[model samples]
Target chain A: MKAIGSFKGEPITDSDSLVDVEVPTPDLAEHDVLVEVKAVSVNPVDTKLRAGAPSQKEPLILGFDAVGIVVKTGSNTTKFSKGDRVWYSGTTKRPGSNEAYQAVDERLVAKAPRSLTDEAAAAMPLTSITAYELLFEKMGANFGQLANPGKTLLIVNGAGGVGSVLSQLAKWAGFTVIATASPANFDWLRANGVDQPIDYHDDLETQVQGLGHHFVDAAVILYDVPSYYDAVTKLVAPGGHIGAIVGTQAKLNMEQLKSKSLSLDWEYMFAKGDFDFRMETQGEALRQIAQLVDNNFVHTTLSRTIDSGLNAKNLREAHQVVEEGHVVGKVVVSGPFNGQVNE
Target chain B: MKAIGSFKGEPITDSDSLVDVEVPTPDLAEHDVLVEVKAVSVNPVDTKLRAGAPSQKEPLILGFDAVGIVVKTGSNTTKFSKGDRVWYSGTTKRPGSNEAYQAVDERLVAKAPRSLTDEAAAAMPLTSITAYELLFEKMGANFGQLANPGKTLLIVNGAGGVGSVLSQLAKWAGFTVIATASPANFDWLRANGVDQPIDYHDDLETQVQGLGHHFVDAAVILYDVPSYYDAVTKLVAPGGHIGAIVGTQAKLNMEQLKSKSLSLDWEYMFAKGDFDFRMETQGEALRQIAQLVDNNFVHTTLSRTIDSGLNAKNLREAHQVVEEGHVVGKVVVSGPFNGQVNE
Candidate 1:
């Protein structure tokens, strides 16, 4: 199998930062399905992992989101069959989707939406799963129903990958969506179902208050939580929730949330896969997300595509774009493998 | 009206720490219910507030738990009538419960259980409400049902006021309760429905794992959060919840909970009243708690009583006991008001 990997922590501009390599095809365990990778998306995690991860005996493959086809299944697998199309965000502890073939747990894989192309389907899984879990699981929003009608949500960095889908999901869940982004991306945010788009450069507290909401029912920070911690805390209603995907270096002032009896939740997409806790919920979430996508309730967040196909060079380019941190939605590298293979 | 209060932050042994004062009777608001105080319990919050609260033009009264008879009601009040017995944990923003007469919102008061004495009933409201909210609202357990059968809870400082009630509530909710206290309090803990009482003086993780539970579904820190954070985080099952009532002075490492998708919840009993967020729920919780107490499903945690009655001297002594921090359960001052009155 042909794959692109980073041998050591290095800047993306270095030619050897992400190099072509040959690794044996992964073996399937019980409940595993072998996936023939078709399309993959680049996220901020890829960039971070590529630049700072320790050099390993084997080069580290860095990718999480993929749309692929089931090539084979382990003896105990029941949810998927060979040739079935699927989409998922693979586990963090295992080899990722930046390869020609990968083995993923069947419980974490779901059927890809029939209404979208492989590139588009690949773009939705990671962000969709994250957004769904953040709203429903972490923040206590009801799933598959408008249970939170008239409630408000504040999404920081609303023009980014997770924010793009999260705003739509939160809106569909009957919450009034307030998102923050640059003025240049305001239209994009509004088009994606954001009820109010506040410029991130402005004073967030003042801008949110200008919209007549004294406090939001929930706040999701897609960016640095500490930088916006004070603002987010002040904007949260009593007994409300604040969720974050990005880890912070600064110590958090937990006392700020004490008076309101608020909750601080950390939503890491790989947690279930990493700890083997409720892994089937990922498949369930994806199945529902696929229905939402096919029903036109949600559209693909694929903002850019590397048409040159899945190769070391194209993936490197995608990583560089993600590292820049201002991409409107998602950047995917698609098509057949073009790197050298030893298998 | 005669009241006991502190004019300045001072040691409980100081003669002026808590003194008798005569003030005008409180005027009623639209939803106010005036109660003739009978008994009140001393909690750590009372001690902390009494010793650290700023001096005021009017002496600061510091009591939260009270059992009394309703003497009057405001125009819009409907929950209670004159002469009805009631129990409540009043709002922190109000004058509190250490007085002959108190004006509390009708929505925050509930009928006191007929099965228990005034002192016993008074010991319950604050801790019961805190325990109920921590389990059901904060940790997502179902209210009044054995919804979490076979699940486990770890309650730190299980002999304290909140812990004593929380252990019983968790048991009633069908969760296996694991509590930490000194070996001397093991009998008290077991009597309060703790299934496994580990010595807080020993290694917590080793003690918990030895009891055959690698992790708990929820962990509540009734004491210091930072001191128990590492053990609690490690002992919480994946996708579990950790709640704290006592605030931490140290900055929390929120990243430690990221890998397990754990939630850090702050449970302040006065939050709803402080922010006017769902104040009716406190009364609702108390109503259900009263039913539980009357049915003998849960019992009062009042371990000690001061026969000297509701006066400055007795309150100061109670404060001293709470400040010492080794009491088995709640310490309360009961009987009639024996102080000078303005009327």
Candidate 2:
């Protein structure tokens, strides 16, 4: 199979940053589906891994969000069959989807929405899964029918990929949404279900307080974890939940959260993929997300499309786009080869 | 009314550290009870308050755990009548339980155990309330029957006032209790119900792993917040709950808790007392705890007592005993005054 990967860390602009190579396509297990990837999206993790010089014997393929078509199915596969279109956020520890053909656990892959194009579908999986898990799973958002609609959500760094999708989902789930972004993306974020878009450039706590809400009932932190610990601690209402996906080595003063009886939860989407539990739940969430998208209740965050062929040069271009740091929504790279193509 | 109180921050040995002061006895308000305090137990909070030289125009009486006889009840009082034996963990922010005659909110007081002495009853509240809230409320330990018993709890600083009771409660609730204490108190901690007591003097993580339980489903840190961050983080089972009662000013690395989806909860028993919500529940838990003691289901940690004559000199002696750091359970001082006193 033809794949794009990196062995050494370097700037994406460097010629050797990413290389086109041939590697053995993963063998399908009982629950595995062989997917021929058609479109893939670039995220911050891709650039972070590329710049870090990760130690690896084989080249590390660097794509997680992918839209593909199943070409073959293992004997025990029950969810997908040959010719089925699928979308998923691939496991973090294993090989990724910057390749022509990839084998994925059938439990983590869901049928692609018929209403959207492959590029649009590819951008939704990684961010949607992250946002979904952070809000509903990690934060334990009550989905009971009687849940109050007056609850509030504060989404920090709200114009990013995950935040953009999360804002809409939080609103759909009956929360009044408060999004934080720069003045530039205020209108865009407000149009996407945010009740208010407070400027992130200002003191976040002051800005949030200025909006007349004393505190948020829940919050999702999308940027640096350490920078907003105090702000989140102060802004969260008593007994509220705060979820973050970002990692930090800095010390966290757990005591700051004690007075308000606040709870801090970390949502790493990779846990399920790496630990191999509740994989089907991710797939189910994806299918439900697709239905919401098809019903025009939620929209994709694919803000830019770059036709970097599924090769070293194009992969590096995608990497550079993510590293630029101000991606409005998602940057998806369309296919160099259709799902039907074989080596 | 005579009370022992501190006007300045000084060692307990200082002659003037605690002075006898005459203050006006409080008039009973609606839902108020006038109790004649007979016995009171010393807790760490008393020492912490003493060390800080808490501001007070008049001398400030510092003790939260007390047992007494109800001398008078307001017209609206329904829970107890005059002459009822009672015990309580007083409000941290309010005037505490160190005076000859004290007026207490009717809601915070509970019926003292019929089978136990005043000192025994007083010894249970502050620690009992802290432990009950930390386990059942903060850590979400199910107090109902058919609770999940497969879980394990690692109680750091298990020989302190709160730890001494929480270890037994965790065991009674069917959890595997792993407590940390020094060699001197190992036998006492085990006898109280701790299945395992790792010597906190050694490296905590290595000691915990050496006990064959590599991780815990929940952890309650009663003291020494800053020093145990690493060991607590490493020993937390995936999707575990970590609750701490003490506050730490040091910044912590929040991202270390992300991989396993661990939750951090701070339990300040004082919050509810300060905010005035469901105050009756404290009394109810205390009443139930009294029943547990009457049936010999629980034992008091009070080990020593002194008749302090309700004066500053005797109060200092009580404080000295608590400050020595080797006291296993609790210290109590009874008065030569007409007040309800129970331990």
Candidate 3:
């Protein structure tokens, strides 16, 4: 099987940063399915892991979101069968989808949306799972046939990947969505169901308040956590939830949240995979997301496509596009395994 | 009406740290009940609010937990009638519960336990509300007749006011309770239904691990938050809840929580009262706590009582006992308002 990997932590511009190599096709565990990855999407985690030296003896395969077909299944696998189309953001601890074939726990893999292309399906899994988990699970937002829609949600970076999906979900749940972006992406934010789009370059707190929201029911910080932690605490109502997808080693003045008795929710989409805890829920969440997509309630967030297919060059270009930090939605690379392979 | 108050942020040793002052009896708002406070309990919030200089022109009266008799009820108040025995931890925004007569919202007052003394009833509210909110509400702990008993809860500072009540509630919910206290209070922890007691002086992580728990399902820090935040983070399982009631001005390494997708829940019992958001819930929680007490599922945490009554001297004694720390359970000052009165 051909896989593009970073042998060492290096800039994307370095030719050796991502190189094609041959590796044995992954063996299936009892609950595993061997998937032939058909398409892949580049995310911030992909860039982050790419910039770090791999802990494994093998080179780091940098990918998360993928639409693939089940090639084989382990003896105990029950959720998926061979030839079934699937989409998943596989475990961060294991080899990723930037490969011709990969073994993934069947519980974490869900059927790909029939209405979307492989590239589009690949773009939705990681960000969709992240947004869903943070909004419903971590933040404990309530939604039913008749949930109160008077509640408001603030997304710090609404034009980004997770933000784009989360805003749509929040809108579907009938929440008032206030999101942040530069003036240039205001239209994009509005199109994605953002009720109010505040300029990122301007004062976020002032702008949010200027829009007449004294405090949001919850605020999900999809970007720099430390920079937004204080403001989010202030913007959230007493006893509200504040969700963060970003990590920072720098200390935070968490006491600001104390007076309001707020909750800080950290959403690392791969936590279930890393701990081997509740992996089936990811598949279930993706199934729900797929249903929403097929129903036209939610649309795929794929904004850029590298039809040149999944080679080292296309993978590198996808990483570079995400690294530039202003990509509107998601950048996906379709697959034909044009990357190098050992004879 | 006579009250014991702190006009300045002064040491307990200072003669004027707590002084007898005459203040006007408060009038009732639409939802208010005028209560003649019979007994009061000292809590950390009482001490904390006492330490701070009041923003209002009046001296700060620092009582929170009180058992009283409704002397009058406002036109809109329906929950209480004159002569009704009630228990409450009223809002910090108001004058608090340190006077001969205090006007409080009916929604923040619940019927006092018939089986307990005024002092005993008074000792339960502030801590019980804190514990209930932290355990059930903030942590989102599931509790029912047949809730999964497999979950484990860690209570840091297990012999303190909130810890004493919280441990019992956790036990009732069938949780395996792990609590921290001085070696001297091991018996108290056991008596309070803690399955495992770890010494606070020892290495908490090593001790917790030695007891065969890689992680606890939830941990509530009843004491210093900054000092325990790191260890609590390490001790909580992936996607578990870490609850805190103490506020700290110092910054915390909140990033460590990102990997496990953990949640930090801050439970300030006064949040509802302070914000006027859902004051009715506090009364309902107290009613539940009362039922638990009557059913013998819980007990008053009061250990010592200042039968000398709620005067400047006795109030100072209770404050001193609390400020000294390490006392098991809670301390209370029975009240008949024997302080100086304006003629």
Which candidate number would show the highest TM-score if scored against the true structure?
1
Name the better of 1 and 3 by lDDT. Answer: 1
TM-score of each: 0.97, 0.85, 0.94
Let me know the TM-score candidate 1 reaches against the reference structure. 0.97
Query: After aligning candidate 2 to the native by TM-score, how far in Å is the CA of A158 from where it should be?
Result: 2.2
Q: Assess each prediction's global lDDT (C-alpha) against the native.
A: 0.90, 0.81, 0.87
* Model 3 bad stretches (over 4 Å): A54-58, A143-148, A339-343, B51-58, B143-148, B339-343
Q: What residue runs in model 1 are displaced by over 4 Å at the alpha carbon?
A: A339-343, B339-343
lDDT of 1: 0.90
| Top candidate (lDDT) | 1
Q: Cα lDDT for residue A11, model 2?
A: 82
Tell me the DockQ of each model, to 2 decimals: 0.74, 0.44, 0.70
Q: Least lDDT summed over 10 consecutive residues: which range in candidate 2 chain A?
A: A334-343
List the per-model TM-score of the A chain.
0.97, 0.95, 0.96
Query: Can you tell me the CAPRI class of model 2?
Result: acceptable
Chain B global fold similarity (TM-score) for predicted model 3 against the true chain B? 0.95
Writing each residue's lDDT as its tens digit, candidate 3 over B84-180 gives: 9999999988888888888899999899988899988888998999888877777877755326478999999999999999999999888999999
The digit string of per-residue lDDT tens for model 1 on B223-290 reads 88999999999999877889999988797777788878888989898999998888999999999999
The native-contact fraction of candidate 2 is: 0.65
For all predictions, the C-alpha RMSD in Å is 1.6, 4.2, 2.5
DockQ of 3: 0.70
Question: On residues A163-248, what C-alpha lDDT tens digit does candidate 1 reach at each position?
Answer: 99999998888899999999899999988889999999999999999999989989999998889999999999988899888887
lDDT string for model 2 (A236-274, tens) is: 876677888888887776766788667788877777676
